[model samples]
Target: MAVSPAAAADTDRAGTGDQRPRSRRSGRRRTALAFWAFTGPFLAGLAVFTVVPVAWSAYLSFFDATNTVTPLSEDFVGFGNYTRMLQDQAFLDSLVTFSVFAAFIVPLTFACSLGLALLLDRVRFARAFFRSVFFLPFACSYVVASLVWKMSIFNGVRYGLANAVLDLFGVDDVAWLFNPDPPWYWLVIVSLRLWIQCGFYMILFIAALQQIPAHLYEAAYVDGAKPGRQTFWHITLPQLRATSVAVVMLILIAAYQAFDEFVNLIGNQAYARPPLVYLYYTALGTQQDLGRGSAGALILALIIAIVTLLQGRLLGFGNKEGR
Candidate 1:
């Protein structure tokens, strides 16, 4: 039997209401899919370019591979490369050099940066100008800084600014770079690193210092706390805990990777070189041993990872206690 006109209109309206929800659901799904489709290429490129290459390098570290026309043709040597690295005296020496460098640089950088940040935090006039001046060294290329230090500052003779000033004081010219003595060369390298990095960490500390509530300092003052005592026991040190942890880790990592300055300033002809420079000289200059180079790189990577993990754990523990 044919439906009445009123009944047919009710059925059409019900059907339209049900279909509307389905259409809206489909539109939402399509929009989400389109968003992913747009982002998929970038994600894929990062995995391909960065992640895959690092994985491949780890794989290559186990093999006796050279930079050849065909890398795949290289022989697999298991832990042979690693074993050789363990016995290498030059590798041992480099490890010691890098360790000493880290020991000196990390603490010195933190102390200097913290001091500068505190001083700058109190400054009222031309704060921006002072900050820019301090951070200017970080803006210069490492190679450029190295060259400038080599030629102008540490030039051994009276031609160098340092020696000229010393000469005026009746002091002799110093062998800043070429010295194979106990601490002079190492001191110079450490000083250069401190100068370059202190500015960057100072900026970071300034930012962290800014995040701290001014009311806290005011409260301390209201409580009859002196500036030096309050900063030591309450304000400066506690607020800087997290920033200190980060700066320590960064300085440690950079100290281990000290290469550009050492290479440019002292060159391969130096009596002492850092681990990275030593590895480069071994792989390309003297030994032509890609396997050993890969092994050294892997070892350095492991050391960095272990140190970072330990620092993170310690920092996490401290944060929990602070909370």
Candidate 2:
């Protein structure tokens, strides 16, 4: 339709204004799509694999769903599993064993890793070589390492490496894994854990150690703080405090979850079973009780959470510096 010049100009301007908003809307839509494209897969997998499983486990803990074919047919038992767990003597004993192992391994690994890191940090000759050497054991599979400790080192025979070393000292072969008098199985268990994990923690500490400011050490030296234990105490340790806290937390969590080594080395024996091992036996080993297993798992999780919170409170984790 042929219109006046002024009307045509106004019409053109109105059309341009509408087009601007449409273009902006299209741009925003594309941005939203791109965001989903990048993050959708990961979020979906997390929900399906982790979130769903945890939620289902929580739900399962309240039911008597053991040996059932389907959830619909399962019986609901409210707090029955929790009450039963308290009365299970073997379960209680497993907690005690876990506690003792934690007491030994946590401190031992922390000290050994820190010491190795301190030494390695100062090494100028073949620094990478030394790091790789120590870290090599960590790269090996836990099952493999456990097997090596069980069969090769502490075989409880005259030909075992441990016995060979003892022979050098004129000591007879000892049944390290079987002897219950002093609980010598601990030697095999503890050494295997330390050897496999110490290097990884050493790497962590080494990285933390490297991040410390050289000027701090220099200032310490200038203040008549000689290169001694005092410098390490005042400067190095203070700088590595955060890393140390994290390492200790990891050690505690790992200790509580100690199952692979215990199972591989000692089987399902009462002497070395941790909470997870005991739960495993309860759930699938002969009993086939998934409900009780889930309950025990949740309990263990609670223990871990409480211990973590206590450690965090004591160490002031997540606190801002100076606060």
Candidate 3:
């Protein structure tokens, strides 16, 4: 009752086919394991450097920790820090100031970036040159830029470039940083941020705009659509939706975490301190109130989270329109 040759051949082919799939599955599993093994170090490092520090900071926010030689010597005062933060007038002022700064900086940066990106997108000659020129500021160190603005541009009445220009126009010397007025100082700070940041965002928008199909614009032109209306309805707004979200989020976070500019332009000398700057001064300066500083940092983080959620909701709403 031996099997025929044809039947034996069929059995062999079937066995090989079955083993092929199993071999593929085993290889895939090995590949996955190897990938995880390679990345395990990075994941561990991230936990140690990023996650642990965040958890520690949150935990320390509950204590009356100080920068003194003995951090453990400070008493554990649960929620006392938060309570004082609620009562602190300066903390409240910083919140308002930061809010105002975000309100102005975000829109200004996005609008200017979009405009510049559009302008650059239309240019044909030396486009790379213009892009490099615009984006150069983003590559510059924030501290150096801040110092330059403080000394060279907004220095003071006697030696600042801005004041020199004002003098030519018969305007008197103005206190750029010293002024505590409602909008003037904020405006100047926001302007400097926009100047530095708009270029980076412009490049982002330019990249997005380039991804859009050129044929769509040509088709619209063939159908008698004007450049302005076509761009508004078809090319510009729709293509930029995701990019706009990213840019807004970045600008929002940067605005909330603003420290270097305030530190360099106005120093920790009391007059012009944003929230983070104030927090740094509080945690390290005279009072050495680590609890208050932690509370401020936590509050700022919460505000950013809430705003990000709101923006996400708005983006969802916008995407619902078939974008």
Give lDDT per model, in order. 0.78, 0.85, 0.77
Steric clashes per prediction: 0, 0, 0
RMSD of 2: 9.4
Global Cα lDDT for candidate 3: 0.77
Which candidate has the top score in TM-score?
Answer: 2
- Candidate 1 TM-score over all chains jointly: 0.82
TM accuracy, model 3: 0.84
- Put down candidate 1 lDDT per residue, 222-258, tens digits, no spaces: 9988878655668778877777777887777777778
Instruction: Tell me the lDDT of model 1 at 203.
Output: 98
After superposing candidate 2 on the true structure, give the runs of residues whose Cα lies further than 4 Å from its correct spot. Answer: 1-34, 69-74, 320-323
Top-down TM-score ranking: 2, 3, 1
Overlapping backbone residue pairs in candidate 2 total: 0
TM-scores for candidates 1 onward, in order: 0.82, 0.87, 0.84
Q: Which residues of candidate 1, in runs, are more than 4 Å off?
A: 1-49, 66-74, 269-271, 317-321
Candidate 3 — worst ten consecutive residues by lDDT sum?
1-10
lDDT of 2 by residue, 191-246 (tens): 99999999999999999999889998899888999886999998888888888888
Worst 10 residues of 2 by lDDT: 1-10
